[model samples]
Target: MPKPANDNTRFLVADVANLEAEIDALLGAFPDLQEDETLRADMLEGETSLQAVLTRLLGHEREAASMVTAIKKRADELDARKKRQERRQAAMRALMLRLMKAANLPKVPLTEATVSITKGRDSVEVLDEAALPARFLKVMKSPDKTLIGEALRAGKKVKGAAIKTGDDTLTVRAA
Candidate 1:
């Protein structure tokens, strides 16, 4: 039987924890095993085991990243398909509306549903926005992060904002 997707990850995590504990125990018992050859062999074996577990974990990480990429591509394809369907539906609705208007049928009764064309709500159409009075327009303002960062870097202090360094990120390379 095939294992679940997360089984390998769980097993690798458990292995790493166990290997760490074993290494710690070996270090604590070093004083008691003074000059014993088995202690050196055990430590070497533990180090090897830890390396293997870490390699497996890296492999799993790569697999997870690949899955995410594949899912994103599929999502894009699905979105494109949805948009095409929406356009087709809109065109069909427009055609039906035009035909109904030509036939002077404001409402059509069908077995499953009723189709009707009613007056839409009133809306304002602006031909020249700049010519509008101040009260009829809205003013929006926002802080520019790029400018803020530039000023901060130039040794200027900004109120309610300060330069903050983020934590280091890990990068993995495939061999």
Candidate 2:
């Protein structure tokens, strides 16, 4: 949902893909180098012009192998996290449907909910239900109005607008 989350997934996949491509390129190039080396060694064992270059390339190949190993491990971790997020999104969708049924409203997917509250000049960003310290902020309310009534009963100075849901009232407060 957040930009960082999306970017991270894309980056992990790209990293793995790039590493695979590099490995394939190295293996493809190795065979030709192998034949050249055998010919040169037979013709002139002690003096091969390509020996230094070959040594450097082999060192690079070893370094690339280490990098690829690390990338593979990181890719596995990202894959697991991606799967977990998919599961969470599914569960949240189901919960939203149940809430809609209870409220007797047409089912709708939950979009990003924004609420404003007191904040210091240096305050960094907005808050959300997913990142709240508590699941929901309990607010007293009457049947007259649900959302605004809950906000009025919160007993805190309303700095600005707030969003209310069946389970949570997200009111931003500055640190």
Candidate 3:
């Protein structure tokens, strides 16, 4: 019998979940299985369903990773183009400023916009950091992860900190 769209979708989801749970159970049984030992398809209910599902999932993972790489490459290209445009605009502004200063004009009026030359605000410049007094310097402190990890690994207790072990990650590869 032909199923409705929603029913078909629900069935597929439940089926995949069941397949995953079966695989987990099979792996859990062989905690000390050696590399030479083979897990046959007969271990699962369906003959080759496990192999098919694993192949599909691995292919999807690789496709997603490729998409991310392409997106980052395009973003980098756009950023470089934007920076070049900014540098060009700055250069044009500097040329206009030089011309106005040479002609002794404080402001110039245009149909679209008005360009003006104004005195910049006063500011302090730091020449040498070592020569500065303690009052003028600022100190910042932060936790060191490397030292904390070492302490935890050596069985030393650190206040307000503890190491956590996460679930195993699956590595997808072409075979």
Which one is best on lDDT?
1
lDDT (10s digit) by residue, model 2, range 1-175: 2232356445544544565575455546555545575653553334332344444445545666789999999999999999999999989867766666677766344466532222237755646656756645566864545655677777644556455567654353324
Structural similarity to truth (TM-score) of each candidate: 0.76, 0.37, 0.76
lDDT of 3 by residue, 1-175 (tens): 2242366455655667888787676667755432334444345535437767666556655776999999999999999999999999999999999999999999999999998998999999999999999999999898898999999999999998899998887776556
Worst 10 residues of 2 by lDDT: 43-52
lDDT per residue, candidate 1, 1-175, as tens digits?
2244676566776777788787677667676554676866666566547567767778777888999999999999999999999999999999989999999999999898888999889999999999999999888999899999999999999998999999887888767
What ranges in model 3 sit over 4 Å off? 1-15, 21-42, 45-48
Candidate 1 Cα errors over 4 Å, as ranges: 1-5, 19-48
lDDT at 172 for candidate 1?
85
Better of 1 and 3 by lDDT: 1
Q: Give the Å shift of residue 135 in candidate 1.
A: 3.0
Ranking by lDDT: 1, 3, 2
Candidate no. 1 TM-score: 0.76
Q: Any residue pairs clashing in model 2, and if so which?
A: none
* Ten contiguous residues with the weakest lDDT in model 3: 32-41
